[model samples]
Target: METRKKILITIGDPAGIGPEVALKAFLQFHDKAIVFVGDADVLSEAAALLKLNLAIRAVDSVSEAIFDKGILNIIDVGALRGLSWQKCVPTAIGGRASAQFIRCAVEIILNGGAEALVTAPISKEALMLGGVYYLGHTEMLAELSGATDYAMMLTGGRLRVILATIHTAIRNVPDMITLGRILGVIRHANTAAYMLGIIAPRIAVAGLNPHAGEAGMFGREEIEEIAPAIEAAALEGISVTGPHPPDTIFHKAYNGEVDIVVCMYHDQGLIPLKMIAFDRGVNMTIGLPFIRTSPDHGTAYDIAWQGRASATSMAEAIKMASTLRLPTWR
Candidate 1:
């Protein structure tokens, strides 16, 4: 009985701060429409624990959602219906619940029952323990949506970065940084920049070694792989540069000198972004079959259910995805 297209919000891990922050975030959007695709009971528990003033309604499908300001319409996946949630830690039940919620959300999105997706955070360890094979959201979403060349792009204020590699061991990062890999990520970055309304964006590629490999003094990745990727991208009409000092490219991006930076690995990009927008950054998956965004941070198990988790990032994720269109991830 829903009258409008609703953006679907998936509560990540019931045991973490996902459910609590989800309730807090959606409450800020009185004018925009959204629906929760997770446990109705868990949402109720979060609402009661947080002293949130709102009406929670359970529905069987996306069509049953109602777009009212004070009422939250939820599709109860019931992964943890009668069980108690062990807050602030990883549990098999919590992991299974998280997987189910995300799987259900994918179905709704593919079926056109929703407009876009705003996901809460989920734990990789919990997911693997629960028999969900993927390491993180990007990998899981890529597989489920058939997204082949997808990349994780994080954005905050004027800073934006896409990772050449994510969710992998640091020891294995160097071996993975091939010319093809860097080029693919740069193309994804170009697509992402245009998606964000940046026409002719200055894309920067961060070097794998210090001082951008010091012109082969520190490493050859810059002289051989990184620079080649940048040149190839530029030849294809992308305003790209780099092999810049890994230490300074982020600062340049922060000051708006570059629109998007293709980082060599995970922490290289996230460390800088989180420092700038810890409570407001948005994690977006570029080249997905559908538009998907999430809070830049993960499920805060340390402060889970304390009602201390900030909802600004979650709200910002919803706001960001709500305005985006389906990307051509070719």
Candidate 2:
């Protein structure tokens, strides 16, 4: 029998749409070995709000989880105990509980209980309110795993983008887009391609400036910083190309001309990706010790408990975490 890979999922902020989407995903993917790590009450309330006809089973350990359909198995990290059902807001208590859920998921992966992690969206503001200071899921996971060379890759609708600089001020992006950073992101993109079953990945690098610095007319970051990085990567035997214009690089990725595109900043990559496939996008954290994927969207607080959140992205993230092969890790 082929042993199913055990995957852990953390329902991000209790007050956000994480719980709802997660439950919906479980309903669709009931046969997979999935362990939910979060507050049981929050999940139960979410289930009630969504009118989902399923049982939320709170297991003491991962081994006790029931992968059978109609049962949503959770490992209860104990958060948001007494809050009103479907009325929970972004409070410090909710934030703390969200952080605990992620921590618990990490512990499970390290303890050989799970092979991968698929986290739902967590609120940065809520995390700060709870006194847990980390930029986002990628940074938090990197710190927890002591990984120094990590990259964030977003995949959806025939497009895969790896961000060179993540969660930083726009004004500071030019300075942060160094040769080392671009090189690292290119390498990560190549690794991601390999995991996606692309043996020799054709990488497309997006320029930092308009028209690729207009051949040094608009900006020199591409001429001075990005070009050298591409040269270095090519010399290292990695198939890479461009400093292509930011506006059109994504079109190439969409048309399947390249396996992945190395982007300069967060919005530069995400705008095209979200525009292409907002609902089914999967946020993958590369260079980690274990596989970690999440929904490309954040905690949608407005339509959280109204049963309006879509589970497409969450389901795709879970599927990627379970199926993607990481040959680099071997």
Candidate 3:
């Protein structure tokens, strides 16, 4: 029997449903070794509120964890005290705690202590409030892990969409979408598909303009930028077809016609993905040195403590993180 790979899970915000969903997922996959990196007190409180008698064993190190069924091993960061699950709030302490837990989980993956990482939803505002100056998890992970060119790929069962530009202003997107950027995203999409065990991944690159520029009648971005980039990627031996109409490409990809769709902009890709699999989507970061994925949704502050938050996305993320097997680079 092979040993189960340990996955480092970070509970993003104690005040949010991160702890709850993580606890629930762990309970469901009790056979796998999951190291929860967050406030142990917060997890215990959330478990109590949900009427779950889960044993959160605090371990000093990941190796010390006894991989057993029906038990959760935690690498407690000691972020909160007297954690109240019912009265959860977005406090400075909570924000700082979330940042610290993320840092710890990333470190564990980098140092080879964990096989993969699944981060819960974090608040961009709270993260900034905690004095960490980063837009979101993708940026922070890139900087921390030294990943220069990384793309965000959202996966929901059948549909997979990769973004060219993420978390940038709508007006600034045009300037940022260059030939290099488009090719980089396509390359990452191919690599991500391969990691998911797909050989010779077929990628459909979405055009920036309507109707794929309608032969330069609608817009010149596809004619001048996107089409050329796709041509360049094809010459490199990647199975890529390109400059497809953004509107219809996602529909085809969702139906399994294409392995992945490389979208030109953020909303151009995410709008359809969120519509189809908002609750079950997993946001995976490609071109990173380490494997990193998160649930598609955000902190969901309105339903943080109501026990109304669904764990399906988080559960899918955990399962994906566990299944991803990276190759040994020479």
- Predicted model with the maximum lDDT: 2
Ranking by lDDT: 2, 1, 3
Give the per-residue lDDT digits (tens) of candidate 2, residues 212-234: 99999999999999999999999
The regions of model 1 sitting more than 4 angstroms off are: 1-5, 328-330
- Misplaced by over 4 Å in model 2 are 82-88, 328-330
Better of 1 and 3 by lDDT: 1
Pairs of residues clashing in candidate 3: none
lDDT of each: 0.87, 0.88, 0.84
Q: Encode model 1's per-residue lDDT on 264-296: one tens digit a residue.
A: 999999999988888999999988878899998
Q: Give one clash count per candidate, in the order shown.
A: 0, 0, 0
> Residue 119 CA error for candidate 2 (Å)?
0.6
Q: Please, what are the lDDT tens digits per residue for candidate 3 over residues 180-223?
A: 99999998888888779998788999988889889999978887
Q: After TM-score superposition, what is the CA distance of residue 35 in candidate 2 from its true location, in Å?
A: 0.7
In terms of lDDT, the poorest run of 10 residues in model 3 is: 81-90
User: How well does candidate 2 match the true structure in TM-score terms?
Assistant: 0.95
